[model samples]
Target chain A: MWKWLHPYAKGEATYRLLGAWLPWLAGSALVTLTVGLVWGMLFAPSDYQQGDSYRIIFIHVPSAMFSMGAYTAMAITALIALVWQIRTAEWAIAAIAPVGAVLTFIALFTGAVWGKPMWGTWWEWDARLTSQLILLFLYIGVLALYYAFTDARTGAKAASVLALVGVVNVPIIHFSVYWWNSLHQGATITKFEKPSMAPEMLIPLLISILGFALLTGALVCQRLRNEILKQEIHRPWVHAQLGVAEQER
Target chain B: MAFDSWYDFIDMGGYGFYVWLAYGVTLLALTILVMHGLRTRKQLQQQAVQQQQRQQRLARRKQQERGTA
Candidate 1:
C-alpha cells in the first residue's frame, strides 16, 4: 500500500525528485510571472472607484493566499515527520520555514501598504490584520526553534513541534474577517456569489495568483533539495552521487 | 503606448503608488528568494565535497596504520 511512499522516504530519492522538479517549476514561474505582471499592471482596466489602487490586489491577494498555504504545508510536513519518523520530512519542514516566513512578511507588508490609502491609516488592530500578525510571529517561532539547538536532528524535531502547534492558528486567521465584521473586506476570490470583478481584472488577478504559486513551488523544491543534501552528506549514497559529479567540480 | 505619457502612466487614475508599490515589492522579494536558493545550494554542495574529502582522508590514514601494524 505504501510501496510508492517507501522509495521517496529516503533522502537520496527525494533529492533526485526535487532536482528534476526545480527547473520546471522555476521556468514556469518566470514565464507566468512575466505575463501576469505585464497584463495586470498595464493591460487591465483601472478600477471604477479606487482606480489603480485596486491593482495592488494582484500582489496582495496572491501573497496573502500563499502565506497561509505555505504554513499549512509546513504543518503537514511536520506531522509526517512526527508520525512516520521520516528524516526527509523533518528536513522538508525546516526548509519551508524561512520561505514561509518571507512570504508572510510580504503579505503583511503589502496588506499594510494597501490599507494606508483605503483605510486612511497605515495599520489598524482589525481582526484580520491582527490574526495575520500572529501568523508572522508563528513563522518566526519556527525559525527560532530550528536554530536554538546545536544538534540538527533535535532542532528539526523541536521546530516541527512548534510548526504543528502554530498551524492551529491558520483557521483563526482565515476566518477572522468572516467571523467579525472587520474593516478588512471579506474574500473576493473565494465567495460563492458571482465575482464582483470584471472579466478583464479577474483574468490578470488569476494569472498573478498562478504565477506566485509556481514561484513558491520552485523555491520550496530548491530549498528542500539543499536541505536533503546537507543532512545526508555523511551517507554513502550521497558520497556516491557526488563522485559522479566530481569531474564537473 | 498604453498611456499617452509617463505622467499618465504614473497617475494611473490616482492609484499609481499603491499599484506600482505592490508589484515592485513582489518582484524584489521573489528575485531575492530565487538568488538565495541558488546560493544556498552551491554552499551545500561545497560542504558536501569537503565532508567527502575528510572522510576519504580518515579512511586512508586508518588503512595505512593497519598495514604498518
Candidate 2:
C-alpha cells in the first residue's frame, strides 16, 4: 500500500511531482475562480433579507473552509514527517503554514467585513469567530516554531509537534457555532441534509470553493519546490537542475 | 442578470461598500501571497544559479593550476 508512495519520498522525485502538477493546479484555479466570481457577483440572486451583502458569502465561506483545510493538511504532513522521518514531508509543513495563515487571515477579514452588515458589528468574541482566530494563531505559531531553531531538523520536529497539537482546533472551529451561542451562522454546504442555499447560489459557491482549493495546492507546490531547493542546494541534482534552467534562459 | 445595469451591479443593492471591500481585501491578500511565493522561488533559483557558477569557476581555476604544476 504505502510502498507505491516510496519513490516520492525522495526530495527530487517529490519536487518533480509538484512541478508537474503546478500548471494544472494554477490553470484550473484560474478557470474556476473566474467562472465562480463572475457568476456569483453578477448573476446570483440577491438574498431576500440581506440583499446583495450576502454576496460576500461567495468568498467568505470558501476562504474560511480552505483555511481549516490547509491546517489539516499541514498537520497530516507533520505526522508523516515525525513518524516516518520523511524530509520531504517536513518541508511540506513549512510550505503549507504560510498559505494556511494567509487563508485564515482572509477568512477572518472577510467575516468581519460581512459581520458589519449582518450582525451590526465588525467582530465579536463568539465561539466560531474566536476559534477561527485561534486557528490563525496556531498557524503563526507553527511557522514561528519552525524557524526558531538554528538546526533545521530540530526546528522541524518542534513545528511538527505544534502542528499536531493545534489540529484539535480545526474541528472546534468548524462546530463552534452549533456548540455555542454565536452570531455566526451554522453550516451551509457541510450539513447532513441538502445545503440550505438555493442551487443557483450554491453552485457558484461550490465552484469558488474548488477554485480556492486549487489555488492553495498551487501555492503549496510553489513553496515546497523552493524548500526543496533550499535544502538541496549543495546536491549535484540541484546544480544540474539550475544548469538546465540557465541554459534554457 | 441579478442587476439590470453596470451601476446597479457595482452598487450591489446599496451594500456595495461592504461587498466590494470584502472582495477587494480578499483579492489583495491572495495576490500578495502569490506574488510572495513567486519572488521567493525566483530568489532561491538565483541563489542556486550563483552557487553553480561559483563551483564552475573554482573547477576551472583548479584545472589551470594543475596544468601549470
Candidate 3:
C-alpha cells in the first residue's frame, strides 16, 4: 500500500526529484508570466468603469489565491511530516512557509492598492480584507515558531503543529466574503457560475495564475533542495554530489 | 497601442498610479526574490567549502598528534 512512498523516504531520492522539477517549473513560470502580463496589459479590453486600472487583477488575484493555496499546502506537508516522521516533508514545509508569507503580504498590499481608487479607501475591516489580514498573521506565527527553538527537528515539529492549528482558518478566509456583507466584492474569476469576464480578460488571468503557481513550485523546490543539502552536509553522498555539481559547472 | 500619447498611458484613465504601482511592486518583489535565491546559494556553497577545509585541518592535526605520541 505504501510502497510508492518508500522511494521518496530517502533524502537523496527526494533531492533528485525536486532537482528534476525545478527547471521545468521555472521555465514554465517565466513563459506564462510574460505572456500573461503582456496580453493582459496590452490586448485585454479595459474594464468599462475602472478602465485600465482593473488590469491589476491579473497579478493581484493570482497572488492572493496562491497565498492561500500555498498555506494549505504547507499545512498538509506539516501534518505529513509530523505524523509520518518524514524529514523531506518537514523540509518542504519550512521551505514553503516564507514564500507563502511573502505571497500573502503581496496579496494584502496589492489588494489595498486596488481598493483605494475603486472603493474610495485604502482599506476597511471588511470580510475579505480582515480575513486576509488574519492570513498574514498566521504566516507570521508559523515563521516565528520556526525560529523560536534551537534544535532544528524540535523547531520543525513545533512549527508543524502551529501550521496544523492554523489550517482551521483557511476555510474561513476562503468563505469570508460569502459569510459577511462586506465592502469587498465577492469572487469574480474563481466562481463556478458563469465567469463574468470576457475571454480576452479571462485568458490572461488564468495564465497569470498558472504562472504564479509554477513560480511558487520552482521556489519551493529550490528552497527544499537547499534545506536537504544543508541537513545532509555531513553525509558522504552529499560531498560526492557537490563534487559532481562542481565538475559540471 | 491603445493610448494616444505617453501621458495617456501614464494616466491609465486616471487610475494610473494604482495600476502601475501594483505591477511595479509585484515585479520588484519577484526580482528581489530571484536575486536573493542566487545570493543565498552562493553563500551556502562558500560555507560548505569552509566547512570542508576545517574538517581537513582537523584531520591533519589529529595525524600530527598521533605521530608525536
Q: Top model by DockQ, which number?
A: 2
Model 2 Cα shift for residue A171 (angstroms): 0.8
Collision pairs in model 3: none
CAPRI classification of candidate 3: medium
Off by over 4 Å in 3: A244-249, B61-69
Local error of candidate 3 at residue A234 (angstroms): 2.0
Error of 2 at A71 (Å): 0.5
Per-residue lDDT of candidate 3, residues A127-236 (tens digit): 78888888888888887887788898898899899999998888988888889998877778655688888888999999999999999999888888888888887776
Task: Write candidate 2's Cα lDDT for A139-198 as tens digits.
Answer: 999999999999999999999999999999999998898899999888998647988889
Q: Report the poorest 10 consecutive residues by lDDT, candidate 3 chain A.
A: A240-249
How high is the lDDT of residue A89 in model 2? 92
Native contacts present in each candidate (fraction): 0.54, 0.85, 0.41
Ranking of models by TM-score: 2, 3, 1
DockQ of each: 0.57, 0.82, 0.53
Off by over 4 Å in 2: A243-249
The TM-score values for the models, in the order shown, are 0.92, 0.96, 0.93
Error of 3 at A103 (Å): 0.9
- Candidate 3: residue A6 Cα off by (Å): 2.2
Worst 10 residues of 2 chain A by lDDT: A240-249
- Sort all candidates by lDDT, best to worst: 2, 3, 1
RMSD of 2: 1.9
